[model samples]
Target: MSIVISNPPYNMKWQHPFFAQSQSRFDLGLPPENNANFAFVLSALDHSEKATFILPNAVLYTSNKDEFIVKKNLVDKNYLEAVISLPGNMFESTSIPTCILVFNKRKSHSYTQVIDLKGKETKEIRDQRGQYGKTNTNRVYKKELNVLSNDVIKEVLSVIESRKNEVGFTKSVSINDIKEQEYDLNPGKYIDTESVDNIHRPYEDIIKDLNRIIESKNGVKITINEKMAKDLEIYDLMQDFKQSKELNKNMNEMLKAVNPNLKIKKEDIAALSRNKEMKFEVKNFERVPEMIALFISMWKQFVMTLNNEENRLLVELRDALLPDLISGDIDVSQNEYDAKEDK
Candidate 1:
């Protein structure tokens, strides 16, 4: 068994320069500033049997064509075995998320193992020693760690042994599938990381929710009706007062037209009203209270009809602003309307 730990000199040239030439043939441009060594590492991985490597994450993923060519060559030759991603705070001195790559030429198992040890039980540093002391001084305790626990490791091993394709978190894909992602080795891209809620709620629960909604709507209607009733009473009183004033003006105009020289005072009106009441001539049914009641009833009916039409118009305007409930044409998730007001 051979293990190659490779981190080539940044400016070193390979023995066979065919891999460097491959970049040009593949139309991938030269690797950029201070980091052209990844091309040689790719060349080494192409020739070696098994290798362990350290690399910047950018080498694995970049929009540049040269990087793509190098990645494509390594993956196409089946040099990649497994990738282990570590937690962000592992490198205390620097601020970079690091990972370890294990590559192999031939494997006895169908899938490789990846154990993350970054957030495991950390040791306390006493003096310059690399060993832990009896009295703990570091921040991390054994209980407050998030390593690959025993149960987690067992589960991963079980899946690897069973060779079953699991969904979410962990899975295996063919080489062609990896190529489809353009040789990016990020687990998030391949893994189905979406949350899936599969539990079915009962019909009774839905009915209860709908009932609550209906009761809330009815409460709103009651409040609106109460306010409208008070407004209606005030509006009717004002309208009656306006109509009475107009009627008195019309009567005065009629009296002046009939007898232009007759100046009628309030006392004279009262005496005339009393004399008319005392005279009490026999009147036909057509000209009595029936005519007056009929005219008043006709006015009330006209007002009611007008109020109903006005309310209908207001309802139509409200409906135009609201979105349709069916088909989900608009997203009303928070019930916020996308309305703009003119200043």
Candidate 2:
């Protein structure tokens, strides 16, 4: 069977329906003149039994009336076989996201495979290449560009053929499900992470914590019993506990150094834990990334503060300068003003 693989120019604009009028490939009708994304798909399908093309996420469920019709027909006809979402910044010039859209004339399954590789910490292939290629005279700085490794290619192919659901990664979605979602083929729309209900700390750790709390409570009770066994008065028992155990010599001295009458309230508790659990929270979308997103969110706050302070400084400078420039106390020439502004 003939197969066509291409990555046509994204969202290219062409002459209106006039350019598409006589084109037999566009039996589904002309795509919007503003975007030739679907037009490229139609052209490939006409000449081949199957077509696999790279397209932007916008094509998945664009509200554009012309494109929606073509998108719907593709699902209805079962031309869509799989949609593999790749990480953003997959392209050099544009960080606009891209994904692999596979169309098949002979699909063995009733469902389309959906693979999501847009992970925050997922393993990626990258190559060091110059952003600007060799200029015979000046040097170019090479930056790491994400690329497709052979292993990743094979893994994707296997998953598409297998249709075995991998949690937070790949899912096999029915055509009916696609229709219900209005033919939206973005993997994220159909994929979900494991439920929070299923998440639990280790059973051994839980048991250990339970025992520790009980032991602490029991230790406090034993200490009270020892005091009572000595037949000491309740007030004396409390005083000794404070003087010997609760407050150290340094604490007593500090209290005396302040006002002798001043006191810090003390309590006898069955259990107390001074440890704090460290928490890390980021806006994670199912299997999507977190650290980079966390950094971006933190940096945004700094940017906002810097801009606000800059505006305040400018206003203050303007307010300070008006009287100085007008009173002739500080002679300011036009060149001096321009030079100061430049600096």
TM-scores of the models, in the given order?
A: 0.39, 0.53
| Residue-level lDDT tens digits of model 2 in 14-40 | 666565667778777678776788988
* Candidate 2: C-alpha RMSD after superposition: 29.0
Tell me how far candidate 1 lies from the true structure as C-alpha RMSD in angstroms.
Answer: 35.0
User: Count of backbone clashes for each model?
Assistant: 0, 1
For model 1, the local distance difference test gives 0.40
Q: In model 1, which regions exceed 4 Å deviation?
A: 6-33, 107-168, 197-343
Alpha carbon lDDT at 143, candidate 1: 17
lDDT of each: 0.40, 0.56
Residue-wise lDDT of candidate 1 within 58-143, one digit each (tens)? 44455556556666665666656665544432322222234556677686554443333333424333222221333445443221
Please tell me which predicted candidate would have the highest TM-score against the true structure.
2
lDDT of 1 at 331: 38
